[model samples]
Target: MAEVQQNTGGDGKKGQQKKMQIRVDFTPMVDMNMLLITFFMLCTTMIKSQTLTIALPSNEKVDNVENMSQASEDDAVTIILDAKRKAGSMEVDTVNGKVVPVVYYYFGKPGGPEGLGDAPETIAARNNLQESEFLGNDEKSGKARGIREIIQQRNKDVLTEINKLKEKYASGGFGSLETKEGREKAQLAYDEAASKVRKDENLKKPVIIIKSTPQASFGSLVSVLDEMQINSISKYQIDNMTKADSVMVIDYQNRHHK
Candidate 1:
């Protein structure tokens, strides 16, 4: 509510004009603001923070030989992350103020059936470590390149089944994707089918092992894990780098970079 008061000076001259004053009462407005704040606080829904779930390695050390034997060497894929080295130096290299990431991968046991031996000559000779980049995909063809291509190739079987399930869902095989309720039900069914495909014992799937050098950036590690999810890889774990892995990487760098 607002009030106006007109004041006329008692002994003023005849030509003197009256003055008016205005005063506004804001108590109601303050109360209304408090009510609005309370209403919003009670009715508004808070967004839950999202996080990615990743499987971390066990604290207890396990023998690599026994681990490899459990899952066939053919199905094992080891991806190593390293910081790019400067020319003719062991220092980390950066591009445009960012550390350049280098990817190295080896299939099966390190150094094949014989394993990585103590001798430097033997390590150099048996080094199966291959270098790759984090190049995501080709823009025109939408084809995966670099490390992504290797992972997709190994997980093609599961992906094939998943793709089929997608086709069925899109064609209303699961249910009608038209209505809201229908879309929800169809999505649930699609998820269940995809889960079955991933867990099917008959499907041939690769077990990926991720390792990183001391100098590798956290962003690079996250990128590799993103690839695992993008490729629909179910069996993947973060593992510590071994001495043999160090030797092989060193030998490979020495041979090629020199």
Candidate 2:
């Protein structure tokens, strides 16, 4: 009985020892979980996407134009006002060395020298004479008449063309002031001129550059802007010196020629 008691105690002690042994093997499992997380992170390149590149201008010290006298003509639209008529003309000269004319057409007059009459009846008379005399039996005459018809179809066409240019420039795109119809009409007008049609390659719209003398009233400048705004050119750069860099710059030295 004593021997049996000793064997039973020995078995109990062995069981107790077995129970005390720590058998937790979490190291391999932890390693596997870490590997899985790292693998997924490396494979997930979708988190990185392409981004747009834009050049940002620096706010460094640059050559500054103190006033209208220091402003450059290259940065302005030069306007020469002919005192003979109360009306003024505009020209667009860009910083990139491009110059274009901002041509204006009278509301009722056909856009040409011959159409420069005091009244609509005079314009009609001029058209009649051109149709009967210079353009007699010629295909050119027929084309000219067609162009006139297009201009006369609606005054809004000209305004629409001007609006298109304004929108283009406002959206950072270059816009031509001349429309296909306007150019065609201008061509017909030139043909009717007494002298050879001196084609103005420089004439365009939207970014009209002009120069007005100091004697010119502020109302004249406002008038030009009004015309542009009416045609939907809401944004414009005036050719003058201002406190803001975004505003137009004027050059007194360049104004000597006009």
- Alpha-carbon local distance difference test for all models: 0.88, 0.34
Instruction: Give the alpha carbon lDDT tens digit for every residue of 1-258 in model 1.
Output: 999988867887787887889999999999999999999999988988666777565566465555656444677999999998999999998999899999999988889779888887888888899999999999999999999999989999999998899999999999998999999999999999989998898999999989899999998998998998788888887777877788888898999986
Q: Candidate 2: which stretches are off by over 4 Å?
A: 1-78, 82-158, 161-205, 240-258
Q: How does residue 4 of candidate 1 score in lDDT?
A: 93
Q: How many residue pairs clash in each candidate at the backbone level?
A: 0, 8
For candidate 1, the TM-score is 0.77
Please give the distance, in angstroms, between residue 162's alpha carbon in candidate 2 and its true position after superposition.
8.3
* Candidate 1: residue 7 Cα off by (Å): 20
RMSD of 2: 22.6
Best by TM-score: 1
- Cand. 2 TM to true fold: 0.21
Model 1: per-residue Cα lDDT at residue 85: 91
